[model samples]
Target: MTETWPARFIAAERYRRHRYAANHPLAIPRVSLTLDLIHSYAALSAEEYLVSRRASEDELAWFHTAEYIEAMQAAERAGKVSRASRQRHNIGNLENPYFHDFFTTPATATGGSIQAAEQVLAGYLAFSPAGGMHHALPDQARGFCFFNDPVLAIMRLRREGWRVLYLDIDAHHGDGVELAFRDDEQVLTFSLHMDTAYAYPFIGGGWRDWGVLGNALNVPLPKATRDGEYRWIFGQLWPRVLRAFQPDAVVLQAGTDILLPDPLGKFAISTGFFLELVEEVLHSAPRHPHGVPRLAVLGGGGYHPLTLARCWTGVWGLLSGRRLDEALPEAGRRVLQAVGWDEDEDEDYYPVLFERRVEAAGDGPPREAIRRLAGDLLEQHPLWRGMT
Candidate 1:
């Protein structure tokens, strides 16, 4: 078994055992599929895989209210929710849903995130594919998330005196994480998501919503955005901002919903570009402000099961320093083929595990909108103003 990589993968069988409510966007297994693909491809040794634990109520208390946590636990135990509990805690609704392990599953993912944070702090890298439930609020469930694991992990990092940069590439804005550290200067929350004007959590990721002292910068992209535009915008501003923030640690919500054909996403980004984006982030880790070479990666949102499996398995490849094969081996292909999705309804033949290279869309509203957003951030945010 190869053992040269300085990273660990957090996962367990429980992630596959518990699933979201039927017909929900998250009902498909995400982490488990990633694990299976990587294992099938022989990407990591047994020593590199860490079984995730469940976050205790105390750990959850760092961000969530005790009453809210108790209510969720009660709902899970009883396998149902009272009308008042549902109304108050936002559980039992179609968006949040009621199911056994509703609390336990998220708690386990939170535990994995917290553990990954600790690993990063210790000068090692870790990827928790089940973490990054970014839209959950302290007291309520929102946007298919019941627990905000990224917020919990970031809050824990803050307590250790580490400056954190919360970056999200999800289709939806990271409203909950931004709100958690909106006023604090220690954490800089930067998200590039679809404009919330017509998307879920329709309140954040706007240029006008910069946090205290320019701590939060939201670059809202237009629908059907292409890879080149994203590359252009990110290349123009993000490197300068990262240098300015000089974060002690970076917690990236690496959501793959931006890939084309995602049921919930509007962007036209390909999986290859998504992998490249993560590669850039990893490459910048050593130059962090605090001289801390630590990074914690978490999975956020990807409704397409095959895409999630491919993208996140690629994430594990990058973190583990394993070279990925362009074409998946037969074993890995079998793993992805086993996943049931609406996409599979058509006639067969998905030969590759990674997305094929493609060109960016031509000029339009999406490009113009991204340019404006980038210009606003570069011109207005304190981090970019000095650079300008």
Candidate 2:
């Protein structure tokens, strides 16, 4: 009989206290809300929960520069950023504001990702919902990301000499992570995101921006990409890349921003499709010699707080192999009721967001544009050509 590997969830209560500014897209509670929903449904057992630690300066240095780390710390201590630090580190800017606990928040998230990587290395599947800040650069912040935890997590795995495949399905491109490993042959970075024409960090992530070592693949989908189109492209490309890379481990940036109703993303993806994607990754992840699959899952850009909480809670359920109650328990309903939403969010879906499962809408006809893009990718990409 095959032995079952354990699945662990890494989180920290500090997330509830450390939040971005009010106007920021990330200001809404995400990790905390998800945890509340999980607790309400009794989805996770005590043994499956792992408290996250704060990443040390040396650990942050794995991907971030020492100078940048010091600048962030100083800014955080003062609860503000100096003119010079703002210009140099891009911290005090409107995009990456200097908020309370600016440094500690990302550092803690980075530490959670490090823990997730350690758990994966030890033969357990791990999920870090507080991690996946994939837009921060080595010395600067961008796209509301203060630190690049996904890069740090991948770096942790690389320390063990593991060839890691970084898969990012966030609506926005994972520019920081892709750029960090662009020249490294041991790491393969694949990002399926909204086309730069319509998305933030509106550069690169195009077909022509394949990494220096041909270890990067960026699939830029058009806005309003529906479930069928998304799945069709993923089916054609994901397995092909997985086979070509043959990585020892897989790091998934499971960003719920790709789902429908997200203010930042235009994709029409649903919770059902999102769960299917996660299931595919779990089953297809490369296993170690001891028969344990090496996989680390991290959360990314999800703006709709209620939707994000529901999606991530479902993710934990899938990981823990729990049959979640479809109806929202009274406690779960209370949790959802307490969540604050922006004036821009549609209130019509508020009631259904309390439920554990959100069924996907019927898939529409496949788009010819998606078909053409997939065909070109398979025929012209260096990885695919080499495989052929």
Model 2 stretches astray by more than 4 angstroms: 1-4, 342-348, 356-361
What tens digits encode model 1's per-residue C-alpha lDDT throughout 113-215? 9988888877678899889899998899988788899998888888899889989999889989988887788999888889888888887647778876778
Q: State TM-scores per candidate.
A: 0.92, 0.96
Candidate lDDT values, in order: 0.81, 0.86
lDDT of 2: 0.86
- Which residue pairs collide, candidate 1? 246-289
TM-score: which candidate is best? 2
lDDT for residue 256 in candidate 1, whole number 0-100: 83
